[model samples]
Target: MIQLVVSIILYFVIFFGIAFILNMLLRRTWLMAFLYPFVVLIIVDNMSTMEYLKAPGSAFSEAFSRLMQITPVDIAILVAGFAGTIVSGIIIKLLRKSGYQMF
Candidate 1:
């Protein structure tokens, strides 16, 4: 489980690292706080769309036929991604409120 923990930490580090850089680069813009979530959703949508498109015609056409087969995994990923974003947002908000002022 140590490996899992390490990877999770790394994920947050990378995401927050990007946020840190973006906050610095886009300081005082109408972008940083508000645009981030929508940006993430759009990115995720594009990626999933690309994955679907890359599958074979017959396979991709029936991809959702097995939707319930991996419901747990899908739910876990959705929860993790949703929770991660909220947690990260809170982390950034708290850090900024603590006078760090990321944006």
Candidate 2:
């Protein structure tokens, strides 16, 4: 209950944090900016899968099983990561257009 809610919040925070850092670091490169987070989400998913594999029968595994489901919070995190990347890309492009360099 409360723990699940907390886990969802944590996942959202971490996912967006990673996307933001990658966005800033690769702002000058459009493809990387758009693609890096997508790849990162795959890694995150893999991590959840690994958690499942490491403990196939336990409360820990059940918690991770719920997290891996297609829940609204999970969807929101994915959307936030994607949108943040695009918004950062657009900001970088606009800055460049205005003769401001991003590095």
Candidate 3:
């Protein structure tokens, strides 16, 4: 239980920090949120970029198989990370709306 909580917080902070910086630099509120799934795919899949390029079908199939095997706790952690990205986007949007210079 402790490990699960730690994992959730760790993932959330990591994603939030990355997304926050990306939002500040890119000046797009939801860019990181929109790209979070692909980031998760890269993290979860074992295939290299070259492998994915060379054998797209097999790579995607393997990735999907691995995705299917993730436990509920892992899914929760991933969801937390996604939520962090969304929250970062919302914060950035709010900051810009309130006349703060984000860029």
Best by TM-score: 3
Instruction: List ranges where model 2 is wrong by over 4 Å.
Output: 1-28, 36-44, 47-68
- lDDT for model 3 comes to 0.91
lDDT of each: 0.51, 0.57, 0.91
Worst 10-residue lDDT window, candidate 2 = 37-46
**Between which residue pairs do clashes occur in model 3?**
none
What are the per-residue Cα lDDT tens digits for candidate 3 across 15-63? 9999999999988888988999888888889778788899999998998
After superposition of all CA atoms, the RMSD between model 2 and the true structure is: 7.2
What is the Cα-based lDDT of residue 74 in candidate 2?
Answer: 59
Error of 3 at 92 (Å): 0.4
Higher-lDDT candidate among 1 and 3? 3
Best by lDDT: 3
Per residue, candidate 1 scores C-alpha lDDT tens digits across 1-103 of 5755665566556655555566556653223346555444443443455655577564444544444344454444444444544555666667677888653
Give the distance in Å from residue 25's predicted Cα in candidate 2 to where it truly belongs: 5.3
